[model samples]
Target: MYMSTILKIAVRNLTRYTRRTLLTATLISIGVIFVIVFGGLASSFKNSMINVITGSLLADIQIHKKGYVESIDNLPLNIFLSSEETAEATKIISGNPNVVASSPRIKFSAMLSNYAQTSGVRLVAIYPDKEIKTCPDLAQRIKGRKDLSSIVNPGEILVPELLFKGLSLKLGDEIVVVATNRDGAVNGVTLRVAGYSEGVMGPSGKDGYIHIEDATSLLRMEIPEISEIAIKLKEFKYLSSSYKKLADTINGDTFEVHTWEHLTPFSTIVKIVDVLILMVRVILTSIVLVSIMNIMMMSVYERIGEIGMIAALGTLPRQILSIFFLEGILLGLISTVVGAIVAVVILTILTITKLEFKFGSMNIALTPGIPWSEMLITVTIVMVISAIATLQPAIKASKLEPVDALGHV
Candidate 1:
């Protein structure tokens, strides 16, 4: 039989049971809509949170001395990058075309005193110009700072909001920061509070920023030392390629390079979100399998007499099988197309609504969309599953004996 003839027969048979076909297609369509919409929303949320993290502070990647991360909680000064190592890293970073900007930091734990009150704080000392370039949104997180061109200057500090509130410190107020050097020598420096920095993780964060010059003065170091380097990329999509290149060139026994995901606890939540999306796909697959198989089986059972008559009239078994298989394929194709259109419309509406929500101290807006690749994959899954689900029933219909099927009521 010609393919066209088989398709026409399939269409006629489906129309013969219009209600059943519509119900099955509706179920499959609902499943497709759910998967696409949920996947879009989840992906949008993940991307938004990542932007908040990388833009506000983490940057796209970070470089540090080996074993520094293991003892990061202590902010050990002994493991800082040596002058030579810092120079080499700087040279490599400057030569990389993918690196948009990089900032060297001197991180340490210190006691902050507002004359009457004292608190332990973790401080990151950086060059104002480089830090602003590396972390574009860093300036926005600082309060009452209109001259963002200079985020923090020499003899000045950006205190965490929690610290500022707890110590009753105001901008431009003098504060004393005391710390112990690598050789166990105690030192202190007086700095003016430049601004209050909002915490990325709500009120629990105690991180503050100061100029590198002040850090050198407080640590009493003869030469400038760097604890780590935060780097931004030209584009986030090139992160893997850039990381591999940097790792091959700079990562060694004394130094290490890591992406933002490796440095934060938020990576775990990203993984969990991915797993949940996979689970939703699995559920959609189950729905398609059960709905298509059940409908095809019922169709075969109801049309046994018609199948036997066709066989008696010299219709080949292969032709009979093709007819039933085509019906399943057509059902899947139509339902998937309908579902995709509906999903696109619904997602567009959501984007237009400009839904907003907060994660920690960051506000995020949802812009949900389904990429073409995702839509193609979803359609392929449905079509393939539809064909598989109809196989057993198609075979049963093709193997029926004419005399036995004719004897049935």
Candidate 2:
């Protein structure tokens, strides 16, 4: 028999029991939908978390003074670049096409004390104009403050809302900040709380910000003694390339470069969640594979007499095997198409309706949406698994004795 005749016969045989075929295909479709929807939602969640963290402060890459990351606890007061190095770095970064913008920042741990309350906070002295350009939230949240038009403005600062709440501070309240200078000398300065900003990070929400010059003068550090260089990029995929280029151009002993992934440990935890979600999707796919295997096996068994008759009537054993394999392939293709369409429709409806997610202890109001790329991948994986699952059954059917198979059926 010709290959086309065998395929036609196999397809017709599949259609003969429409209900069973439909059931098997439906199960495969369910698995595919699960994988696609979950993969998409997980991706979205990770992206959202990244936006939240980056929006609050840290940019895509943070270039810190050498040894600052490793020994943040015992920060070396004088471990920073000179004026020339700072100018050089600024020039290179500003010139790089991949670099969107860069801001120089001075970091220190300090205690903010009021009449009735005292809370420890990390103090960041940032270039206001550059910070506003990259982080508009900083600009938007400024309240009870004067105009901020320069990097070396006299007395501008941003404090987090939590700090304000903890100290019962209203706008314009004078807060005393005690910080250690570059020479390990403790110095205190009084700065009016310029504004209170909200943050996604706990520490950031608890900390305070001061003007570049005011913070430098208070900390008694030279204007060139910036501790970190925060940079935003045109694209995140360019992060590694930009970082490598910057590192190569600068002396490694003088500065260390880090991406947002390294700067914020929270992103790492989110990545771990992504891995777990993928593993769950694989497990679901395996379940579908097992179901497909069982469907193919049963299909082969039920058609033993037909297969034997075809083989005995001058059809080659290999051709008989090919027929069974073709049946599986066709079933998989049909399932994939149907599953993709059904999943898309379902997801669209759910998205339109704004499906509410209510897990055991979490209630999140978000769309359960899947992207087209994820849908395509899910369909492809399901089809491949289905084809692989049918291989053993195809081989068994091909090796069967014609007489015995015909007699049993």
Residue 240, model 2: lDDT of 84
Task: Please state the error at residue 17 of candidate 2 in Å.
Answer: 2.5
Model 1 C-alpha lDDT versus the unseen true structure = 0.88
Q: Estimate the TM-score of every prediction.
A: 0.96, 0.88
Give the alpha carbon lDDT tens digit for every residue of 298-357 in model 1. 988888888989888998898889888898888888889999999889888998897798
**Largest lDDT belongs to which candidate?**
1
Count backbone clashes in candidate 1: 0
Q: Residues 1-409, candidate 2, lDDT per residue (tens digit)?
A: 4877878987997898899888987877777767776766676566655655554478777777787787665555676656677777788788779987788887778878876788887777887777765554455344445554542245645676778776788767777888888677888888877676655544245556787787778887665478777888887778789988988877787778887888767877787977877786688678667877888899888888887888788778889889888888888888778777777787778678875553321233456575888877777777688779888999999999989888964
- Per-model C-alpha lDDT, please? 0.88, 0.74
Query: On a 0 to 1 TM-score scale, where does candidate 1 land against the true structure?
Result: 0.96
TM-score of 2: 0.88
Q: Which clashing pairs does model 1 show?
A: none
